[model samples]
Target: MTSVPTPDPGPGRQSRPAPHDQRSRPVPRPRPPGPADEPFDLLGIGIGPFNLSLAALADGVPGLAAAFYDQRPDFRWHPGLLIDGATLQVPFLADLVTLADPASHWTFLNYLKHRERLFPFYFAERFHVHRAEYDAYCRWVAESLPSTHFGQQADTVRWNAARGLFEVDHTHLDEHGEAEALDRTYARHLVLGIGTEPYVPEPLRPLADAPAVPVVHSAQYTENRERLLAAEHITVIGSGQSGAEVFLDLLRARPAGYERITWLARTPAFAPMEYSKLGLEHFTPDYTRYFHALPEQVRDRLVPQQWQLHKGIDTETITAIHDELYRRTLDGGWPDAVLTPGVSVRTAGRLGSREVELHLEHAEQGTRSRLVTSAVVLATGYRERPLDRLLAPLGPALRTDAAGRPAVDALHRLELDRSVTGRVYVQNAERHTHGVGAPDLGLAAWRSAVILNDLTALLTGEEHYPLPVRTAFTTFGLGGPPPAATGTATRTAALRHG
Candidate 1:
């Protein structure tokens, strides 16, 4: 990890204006309150990876009071796809504290050491461990941060006129499955680290309501994997990483002697992520600068082209699936799994007690076809829907990019015109503004640090802890910005409707 100053945009890329001059629309800074101000210094809306990382970082920072609330009762990463053998797309070093505090007791390496697998894991000589291992590591980190954890669903966030702070309304769901309880938290800063929800295509949404058809998103595969595996025929939709991974997982887990599997996707071809070292730099903080500086349309073009890097499976996984299929072919066996790319599901209707009728359009075939399957698995991916519905009245105040993504700065603060004084930080909701690494572990710690810095800067006169350049280099594990400092234009306007 090497650190550099922000760089100038390359050919065809947009250059950034100086920070102060470009967006001089006075950020509605909240006035600092007296001793009777608030209970917690900050309130984190979601306890997913990003905010989880924030909790870990906050633990070490003195006088920084924080509490994280999650809709789930306990800490669980994507439990549905916690496939037995699936591995993290990135290195295990990207765990919670390794990038931020390598020697910290809560690192994945430390978790392995504490579990007495440190030496064994090293001897295994694997770059990435099973996805289960990463989940366990995250659980360990979450458990250690218990004091700051709140198991409740935040229903809405509104600025309390009297308190002069953000009031978060939460529905508490405790262990043993009880009903909701009234719980509230007031803080000077609110961080919306709410995780993403699984997405299924509109044509398939009705299938979700059909019990007989048994439809589910790829993220929840683990829960339905056994049943889907036992089914005579399985149809998987979407060509992204999750879809591919789920299709491969099912194919590999055939019940001794299963016949065939149908994998359908809308893309023309299954594309591999850019594997070049330089290409990977698009995930670094440096890229965030370059991406933030781009014109809206150019940024839109860049996203779809680079979607595979963030949404698709790694090269190793793709190759593994290909190798397995090839082996079966060499053994005089036709591939049981059929990966149909460039096929769109036109519509789906409930069939008999156990099947779904799907009208599909194949681009190359230039024809329409119907497929009946015992089950449908949607790996179509997800959208970062507006926080407005959840924010209620606050939605009117929140700003957006030209594309309607939550407008944000490099610091992950939602761009708002006026409405509220306290800062609203978003963790997983800034992809359009922040780029591919927006929700990754590499940016988790740094983003949290920046949010905290901004919050403190707004509330108190103290500047956020200046991140040591060494930490940025080590934690990011990618090339940094350029060496020379850049300048921002005065009174420049950029579109940020989302």
Candidate 2:
């Protein structure tokens, strides 16, 4: 098997450019048109962690023909937000395939072993690995997995009624990212894992686009760090983990008495995440099952009330920020920094060629104020990328919820017309149907296993990946007996004599 050569380790995140000569590269070449006629067992649209997990697991199953495609030249995960010392919130066990198949060669432990860092990682006793290291581990898997194809952009997907398969059109890009050729392939099943994109609120959207100042989403913080630090004043918007990390980093880098930074959030407070033992059960498969069974209205109402589950800052990050501020006061002076919650940007305008004026409002107090800053960082989080354009061909066959979002079933299949026999699966795109676990890394392996099991069940008569009978100790709802109960309950009505 051919393999992509790994790049040398560097001080920061590192990635190798595609080979200058495509002919000599190990990257998969477009197959002949006649060979594309043979349908694959599974064709994945995106190569994010979720699909990467599926590919890793699928590699172990014999005779399973699977292929994954990504538009980028190589794998890179949130590269800009990989702040130094930042760690994944999930444990290392939440890697691509360990939770589902611990014996798999693609596990994080295996990656460490391959890199000769196993002993050091073992001695560190770190449950949460650094974010940059995780990215590197994913790249290692992508480079090694034969089923993954990079530099291929999936343009369209449509069901072929006559062929009883799904046809996917793609453009194969050359080393320089120019479209060199177009190709089409067929598949019996499809999985969409395009993932989410960073979002900037309406009030700050203009500033983020103008680029006159150092205004950027926290997703691009690393790229703009030097310019932001050199500015006279900086203001960070949003109180989530990313906002906190950026603020903390800037605070530490600036002089104690001249920090000149302001942090603002619309949330009532800079809250710590709900990381208690029982509180975390919401991320388990059990909770996902319960959420999927909920009525549309109920699920819509409940999601906003559970913001602390996924949107709050980690306790450690909050503590680090506080500790840095406290340490600055050791010389009998406070740091020149302001941290305010319950505040939001109402409107923003340019004060001059280089300064930004933000009109702010306090939600609780109903007070208003204005502030001018040389730079702004919006860490307002991300939203699911809309699938309308990609799935436009099959729009008529899709079933949508009250809000017009695709209605995803418990099995993660998009509800579609009965005429469409080939299944359309999704990953990290069903938060309304699957709850908070939809995008959580800890659930990636398990979700992949679930998808594989369902697909195999349809192909054969039995499941390929036996799902765990139970995952969480807490039962999610009261309508049914606990999952452990063997007996089934029957409801009967007493009829009155006429």
Candidate 3:
């Protein structure tokens, strides 16, 4: 029942830092008027965690001119999925700037200090913080940062051949998300951290798109939780953590004997996520480097097979679910809940006014059936938001791989034509190139450091953000190590810290 206190709100896009200590002192007022007409060293699109990490790390660097934009009026990470008692998958060390620079002013520890909650957090001994708390911590960082501009939507990007910079057009949005003004900025380098959008399966998209249907994607679960809970019978579809969490939440809300819920998973079983010590190495930089070096075909084949790594319910949540179900069974028979796996929703449609019918196919049993439910929650997960419209102006300069996907190099920079002097880097849009770590919070700080270091070295001869050469105990490939991934200057800086 505890809560973290928020700092005092100041006028527009800025806030007054708490008087926790000298470190909490306001970062100079009026926020530096960043090069209005001149090109910034880097202009990042999307202020999600990945790019937020970049912005935080860049704050500590001396002279890097960078800015981050997002369409949202304020920072909110997966707002709908912030189920009560649901914690982040990764530990707190995976916060905005801790892994890359523990001493950073923007670290979670610093945020805790700023909020005057260090003693509480220390005594609580909680490693993986609640999802809501993580969102609040990020909002704390985003609001305090002068370089991060929310309510700004990047509309188009083009490479200026003569100027050797990237020109970005953005729309300044008001509180209601309407475009208030047109603005433009130029940057020598661009980073896209647009992040992902909730993906409802095609079969269930119709009901979800219907204005009155009691169907929602897990991404918006919290928003529609009340409506869904009031339904006669609710069916939750998905095998990932979101589905598990949503099902668990619904079950807990319903009466003991009349749970009136069905949990359908496409996977063979309600399996636990891979969380073993060594199993987690796949999210380290070592694995990302090894995976990026492999031939494209091999890389493509490996991702789907490794789903349990990045996409499964944690044992804790799974145990909590079982415990709840077990508690219900103690009274008499089982709760009015049906949990089935290896089932796919072939199609779904509204049944007149008060119900929905879903045509389902059981994979292993080779059977088909229909399930009528009053409400549906599709936890089918998310897809990377397409960058086509935003980057269309780049045209031929934006290279692609054999799969027609953007070709991202080992440094996370898009492989573009040699004629274009500017670089376009990606954050979560490079899973095929960077392996599973592309979207992981554990690797967020590290990846940001990598991008910042590379970009800094381009401007100045020195590497600003030092990174360790080896991250994982496992040698990812048959080779001992991928050829030292950093330049000599960068390697030396990392070796000092390694």
lDDT per prediction? 0.67, 0.82, 0.81
Q: In model 1, which runs have C-alpha deviations exceeding 4 angstroms?
A: 1-37, 255-257, 456-481, 484-498
Name the TM-score of candidate 3: 0.92
Model 2, residue 32: distance off in Å is 8.1
* Candidate 2 TM-score over all chains jointly: 0.91
Residues 192-311 of candidate 2 have per-residue lDDT tens digits of 989889998899877855567899899899999999999999999998899999999999999989999999999999999999999999988778877887899999999999999999
* 338-362: candidate 3 lDDT, tens digit per residue: 9999999999887887788899999
Q: Model 1, 264-369: lDDT tens per residue?
A: 8788877776666766766665567567777878877888777667766678778987886776677565776778888999888788888888999999989999
Segments in model 3 whose C-alpha atoms lie over 4 Å from true places: 1-36, 482-498
- Higher-scoring candidate on TM-score, 1 or 3: 3
Q: What lDDT does candidate 3 reach at residue 143?
A: 71
Candidate 3 worst ten-residue window by lDDT: 1-10
